[model samples]
Target: MPRRTLPTAEDQAARFVRQREADRKATAEDYVELIADLLREEGEARAVDLARRMGVSQATVTATVGRLQRDGLVETKPYRGLFLTAAGTALAAEAKARHDLVVRFLIAVGLDAGTAEQDAEGIEHHASDKALTAFARFLSERGDTT
Candidate 1:
């Protein structure tokens, strides 16, 4: 058997760049998804509530929300509550779909529901679209519609 070749420096650098980009987007995706959930479940989304659910400080939520507003992903209506822009809503849907797919794939591979959910939180952010498609195909091949 021949020895396997290691990745080139350029390939490694590209991989690292991809990971860094994913890491940066992960927080934004998580926030938008959570806001969407809160809005659907509680009819509103507040920075305090986000902080509590995310285990972060209100100040952190405030800062992040401010950035999101500047990015045109969210809006605030004074006394009302946090609301997602059209772009944000689309993003939240995509994130949720990715997360669900990851969880299902994990479960189909033998992980428990609890562990799959916890692991999917991070895996969904890092998984590429191609990988997600492959997972979906695998599930479909196995007749897993659940």
Candidate 2:
């Protein structure tokens, strides 16, 4: 039998910090991504629509949208739907790319498309750039063009 070594306190703390940061960003990423999708598909993103799509209350959507505005990611016009600032658009594009890459990697590893998509929702948020690059290399090695 081999002896197992536990992580040091510093290592554990760093790991927790990484996870917490990811957790905090997940909601913002999801909102921006959804907003981008809605704008592309329907040409508008309203608080009511976001609430419906997110399965949250309108008040919740309003609160989060306020935070996003303060962060300079979004803007609102009187009687008009929500609009993404340049920063928000860039973030949304990046988030969507990461999500798509994760889904493709999962599928290439033999998971079904539905399962891969569901799993990628969480995995995309937590995966670092290095991890995503490795996944891309693995897919490339496997000759997966799609």
Candidate 3:
């Protein structure tokens, strides 16, 4: 798909650039979902655990946790691992849904497990709900097999 050129506004080039930059940044839901899944899988995980899983540093996980906490998606303690709040659990479920769909889409297109996992991570974050729902339906029609 061709990248859409962002619409320019008269005297709003700065705002446009800022919005573009923001768009380039990772979404809060993405972070929430990742952390939420990790928490689900391991029951609880320290920031270091997630950072390592993501191949980022602990500080990045820490900052993201702070944001998630502010959004009421997580709860953390100084000496313990992080756990998803109820809201976090819901968002995590959505994230997992997106990830699962992307993984299936990649595999359906003949990608290997490793490559599909990597591709799914990015595509899961970028795709719209409509696109994902369509992809889900496509996979369902095809039996959703590997």
Candidate 4:
């Protein structure tokens, strides 16, 4: 077997950049998904609710929500609660799908349900499309759809 060369510094830096960007995107997806859930369960997604769910302070939530608004992902209605725009809705749906797939795959591999749920929270955001496809295929082959 041929020995693989180590990644150069530039390669490492590029990978870091990509990972950071993915993390940032994941944060947005999580917020939108939570907002969608809150809307479904409570008819509204207030800043306080988001802050509580996210385990962050209201100040942090406000800052993040401001950035999301600027990115056209969400919109505020003054006294009304925050709402997702069309783009945000689409992103949330995609994120939710990924999360479900990851959680299911983890459980199928024999991980405890509770551990899988926690592990999936982070893996769902970073798993590659190829890996996700493989996980789906593995589940399908097992005749499992839970």
lDDT of 3 by residue, 60-100 (tens): 87787888788788898778888778887787787777788
Cα-based lDDT at residue 115, candidate 3 = 98
Per-residue lDDT of candidate 1, residues 1-146 (tens digit)? 99999899999999999999999899999999999999999999999999999999999999999989998999999999899999999999999999999999999999999999999999999998899999999999999976
Runs in model 4 deviating more than 4 A are: 1-5
Q: Where in model 3 is the C-alpha error above 4 Å?
A: 1-27
Candidate 1 to truth, TM? 0.95
Q: How high is the lDDT of residue 106 in model 2?
A: 95
Clashes of each: 0, 0, 0, 0
Better of 1 and 4 by lDDT: 1
lDDT of 4 by residue, 9-117 (tens): 9999988887898899988999999999999899999999999999999999999999999999999998899999999899989999999999999999999989998
The better candidate by TM-score, 2 or 3, is 2
> If the candidates were sorted by their lDDT against the true structure, best first, what order would they fall in?
1, 2, 4, 3
